[model samples]
Target: MEVQSAGKETYRAKTSKGEATRQKLLDVAEEIFGAKGYFHTSVVDITQRAGVAQGTFYVYFPGKQHIFRELVEELSHNLRREIQIAVNGAAGRKEKEIRGFAAFFDYVRKHRNLYRIVQEAEFVDPALYKWYYRRLAEGYVKGLQEAMDRGEFRRLDPEAVAYCLMGMGEFLGMRWVLWEKKDVPEEAFRAAMELIMGGLEKRD
Candidate 1:
């Protein structure tokens, strides 16, 4: 699909073949950036790994920074979309949280490169790095606010709570799924949920 950059620069993949090529470049970028780290990976590295020419890289992305920014944006967007879909049709907010956390770990497992590329943004572009987390937190804040309004959760700072939850999922996913190459076990998932439920759930 055609995508416009934040600067209003258009990545016009005008044909099916062009769009495929663009996606191929991005796929290779994700792989290389995750494996080699952004600094060590060069445009030539991306092109060679993608089996595309140097000029072809320019067709989709202007330069390394621009592509890195796009990759961060894309990853941020795809993640939010996935989590939203995962939590859909849930029984309630509590169940939604459970499903959402499970979904997040599942996502991180599939996209094992998420942490490497996103964390590299701290050095590559600090603003974009913050933008990534802030964007993710926006959805979390909205959901938590809704849950509170529904009396499913206690009155608290939604944004702060969102960050707390996001932090929990980030580290848990990193340690269990990303690092260990395995799903979060059932007992551990329940323990984490109970710990969160203790504070978030409304009490008599």
Candidate 2:
């Protein structure tokens, strides 16, 4: 449970309206930050676009950087939640990997600003930028390790494999969803799955 701190006072949305206002601010910030870039975006810009007073902004986020950081954290949380849900319904290790990749592409398609905002974070907040991917990779490593334990995947370094998978998904999303404004094509998806399964499937 995260609370918004304004000076000495801690602000938690006490009502539905209050929570809606806070969420509105975040939603507007995501659009502005993605379009204008962090350095160029201002608190006034966010407040005006959100149709909220400048003081209201402080009630939720202390400043611009706080909102930006919160946005990144929110994206990370939602992404992992979506991927986990999809992977959970999968029948086996191969299905889990395919489902996870599909979930990621779908997420990227929905959140078109994802790449822009994340890339800007490298300069906006270095630790947070790294934390985003590291958190994602943590989930990947855990799942890969489980598959290895079950002998579904060969015993290679889970962390290394996690990063490799992340890189592949990231670029594929960038190439297809972000650039082409479409889902990853069936041919490309099948090829990637074949390449991954070929490498990971256990042998006698």
Best by lDDT: 2
Off by over 4 Å in 1: 1-7
Candidate models: Cα lDDT each: 0.89, 0.89
Q: Write the per-residue lDDT of candidate 2 for residues 28-72, one digit (tens) a residue.
A: 988999999999999999999999999989888878988888888
How much does each candidate deviate from the true structure in C-alpha RMSD? Answer: 2.7, 2.9
> Quick one: how many clashes does candidate 2 have?
0
Q: Which ten-residue region of model 1 has the weakest summed lDDT?
A: 1-10
C-alpha TM-scores of all predictions: 0.95, 0.94
Q: Count the backbone clashes (under 3 Å) in each candidate.
A: 0, 0
**What root-mean-square deviation over C-alphas does model 1 reach?**
2.7
